[model samples]
Target chain A: MELWYSEMHTEDVKFSIRIKEQLLADKSQFQQIDVFESNEFGRFFTLDGLIMVTEKDEFIYHDMIVHVPMATNPNIKNVLVIGAGDGGTVRELSRYKSIEKIDVVEIDKLVVDVCLEYFPNTSVGFKDPRVELFYEDGLKFVRNKGSKYDLIIVDSTDPFGPGEGLFTKEFYGNCYKALTEDGILVNQHESPYYSSYAKSMQRAHKRINEFFPIARVYQAHIPTYPSGHWLFGFASKKYDPLEFDSKKWNELGLKTRYYNTNLHTACFALPNYVIDFLEESKND
Target chain B: MELWYSEMHTEDVKFSIRIKEQLLADKSQFQQIDVFESNEFGRFFTLDGLIMVTEKDEFIYHDMIVHVPMATNPNIKNVLVIGAGDGGTVRELSRYKSIEKIDVVEIDKLVVDVCLEYFPNTSVGFKDPRVELFYEDGLKFVRNKGSKYDLIIVDSTDPFGPGEGLFTKEFYGNCYKALTEDGILVNQHESPYYSSYAKSMQRAHKRINEFFPIARVYQAHIPTYPSGHWLFGFASKKYDPLEFDSKKWNELGLKTRYYNTNLHTACFALPNYVIDFLEESKND
Candidate 1:
């Protein structure tokens, strides 16, 4: 028997993977989660039928998310990661020995439970002494805090279902309050290829722009995503990702699969259409 | 009945597009030529069941192929495009009024005929006075000349079947002889994310490196391709793509969707894994 796991990239587009076995299938109070073993992608897990983490290319996403911010400010000590239940974001954040505290906010505890059981490479960071996991809504978790985190990484899902609230103006305002004076806000900005995802990307960028002095969009190619062209938003109060002395990050010498000093500068160079679309979104 | 056009990106991974209608499907003397109309990608055509051009994102491929070299040395008055049957590459080249002549050598005449009928947006370049079309095998056509063209674009299919010979060492050596001292040679380097495609990419880059003093790889996010992380090779004797004064291209005042001055510089900055892989390929 042949089993395939498919996700509708759009109403008219689908991406599928031939599965070797269905590893796990269960539900939490928030969403349904499924784990599958595949030949091309190795092992992958999905939340509410959307691909969340795949062992094959999770390093691409995690590397881009954690390292870009970490490299921007090497002195970052306290970090806040929102909705990264699989713990890949924290795994990368844990690499910095200088980082004194790493707080992870995941609304679904089942995601952490599943990752702990199935995806050890990513979930291994959960055991780090500096790491703390909070099973609570990220929107609410950041509301109670003030001027705390040096870096806030919103490694969340698409802007719908449980992740919809995290893309709102109010949520961004709370995140702004919860950040240090030189804090950097990095979030999972959706793709620009498909119209549906591009709308969410624009909305997130627009909302974040209102809160931060420097708001920029950067891109990475993550094959398993809806569109391989995935984007991330880098909104900061003091540091410009491009203006930083990359020699500081290069001196640390992190062995990364995707991120590097050269790519750190290159990723922020947005395509002209994306720049035009984001510029238009600012007015609307 | 719902119809879906699915291509196995690898043995286990499939990318599917819902078709509004099957526009055309026929076998040429060389390979299968199929065209489909879709909501997301508009109109797209394939060679031997592999996607070659999609109206929605063809601009990205055509832009990167034609403009990068043109911008590097604006003095390029002569261009030889190999296997760009759809005429999209010629369309972008015709935009530069300084380009006095463009010779397109396509192996399959049928691919051009179908595209001319269905994809007018791309095939429109054939109407330009400076554009010349030669329906012939690019390998043999390029061999009959020496130091004739200012730029040579090997815009063929994958490194197999009809496009296989174009990736050979002998073929690259022929192309090297067919270029002027300052000529630039650009070819479609395959994706690095997949093992199968990465090997092809490595082989192509390794061969191209032998003939050119300066050979480098650049990437673009082409969503419909195998991995969406597509790569292209840039090779020249004297012009390092990085050292060019981009202000010359900026003065041309051409509007582009994907290729901008910023992206022109950034696209060359490859990820660490790709760099390491290419470096390893050099030894083998």
Candidate 2:
């Protein structure tokens, strides 16, 4: 007998995985959460029936998100991570010894509890002395704030449901106000291929562009994502990811499975169609 | 009520689409061919239950396959394409006026006939006077051949069925002998994420390296394929794609939907895990 877990990528498209067992399922205060074990993807979980992370490809997402900003601005000392309750983003961030303090604001404590109970590999770094876990709404935490963190990561979900407020222009304005002069913001911008994700991506980019002087989009290949083509947005007061100091990054000797010095430049090289999409998206 | 068509990405993973109807289904001499009309991916077709091409994302595959080599060596005159019955590669190649002759060899004539009847947007370039279609085995066509062509593209299916021979060392060596002094050979390299696809990718890369001094693997995000992370191998006698003449390609003024000058450099910048897999594959 085959137990299949399926998610609608769009109304017309769906992705399914055959699972060995349904490991966990429950309703969090914010949304419904389910976890399953599978052969191809190993262990995976979903929030509100949408894929959030898979054991096989979560490394790709975590690596691409945390490292790009850290590599772009090597002197980054403080970080504010929003909505990454699974602790994968903090896991990657904890690798940087230069980071003096790490603040993680997750709306759902249940997600973190489940992850710590199940995904030990990803939740490993949460115990770091520099890390602080805040059970609060990210929008409220960022709003009416004083100048602070050198880096902010919006490791969010789709634009609907619980993640809706995080993608707004008002939230972005607050994030800008909460950052130091050289602050960098990285967010899980949606994919460019499917229309649903593209619309969300365009809206996020347009909003972020209005708040930040330097804004760019980069891509990574995460097999379990809607299209396996995932994107991340980088917005900063200064630094361009393309001009990465590869020599310095190499000297840091961070042994990574996915993120590397060569990929630093490569991930930013969007296809012509994507480039055109962004241009049209900006205007549309 | 909803009608869904599903394809197994791996034994444990599958991708499905809500279909308006099955447009075409038949068993060719070589493999099973099925085409379906869908709202999301537009019109898509599968060979032996594996996706061959979709009207929505076929441009990504075609653009990457043809333009990468064309951009690498702008002066390529004579070209040979193997197993691209859909005519997308041929369509893109036909845009290059400098090419004097294009010889396409396909083992199955039925694939071509069906594609010509169905996928006209891609098959449109077959009417060009420069392209000569031959129904023959690509492996046999290149063996003991005179060095005539500057570029040989193996646009084949998975390394099973008729395409199995195309991935062998002997076939690559024959392709090496079939090219002019500055010849370039490009072929489909499978994905590196899933263990099943990774094995095929490793074998193809290892075999190609034996024949060509300048061999590299590049990636493209083709979401319809197994991993949405597809690869292409570039094995050349002389040129490296990174050293592309961007100015010259730009002067040619080809309006592409996918490939671009920046991406030409970026595609080769593979992730660390993929690079590691290739290295480990080489030794194994």
Error of 1 at B30 (Å): 0.5
Worst 10 residues of 1 chain B by lDDT: B237-246
Task: Provide the global lDDT of candidate 1 against the true structure.
Answer: 0.93
Docking class of 2: high
Q: Look at candidate 1 and give me any clashing residue pairs.
A: none
Question: How many steric overlaps are in each model, in order?
Answer: 0, 0
Tell how far residue A79 is off in model 2, in angstroms.
Answer: 0.5
Give me the candidate number with maximum lDDT. Answer: 1
**What CAPRI class is candidate 1?**
high
lDDT tens string, model 1, A1-284?
Answer: 99999999999999999999999999988899999999998999999999999999999999999999899999999999999989899889888989999999999999999999999999998999999889999999999698999999999988888998999999999999999999999999999999999999999989999999999999999999987999999999999999877888888877999999899999999888899989989999
Whole-model lDDT per candidate: 0.93, 0.91
DockQ of 1: 0.94
State every prediction's TM-score relative to the real structure.
Answer: 0.99, 0.99
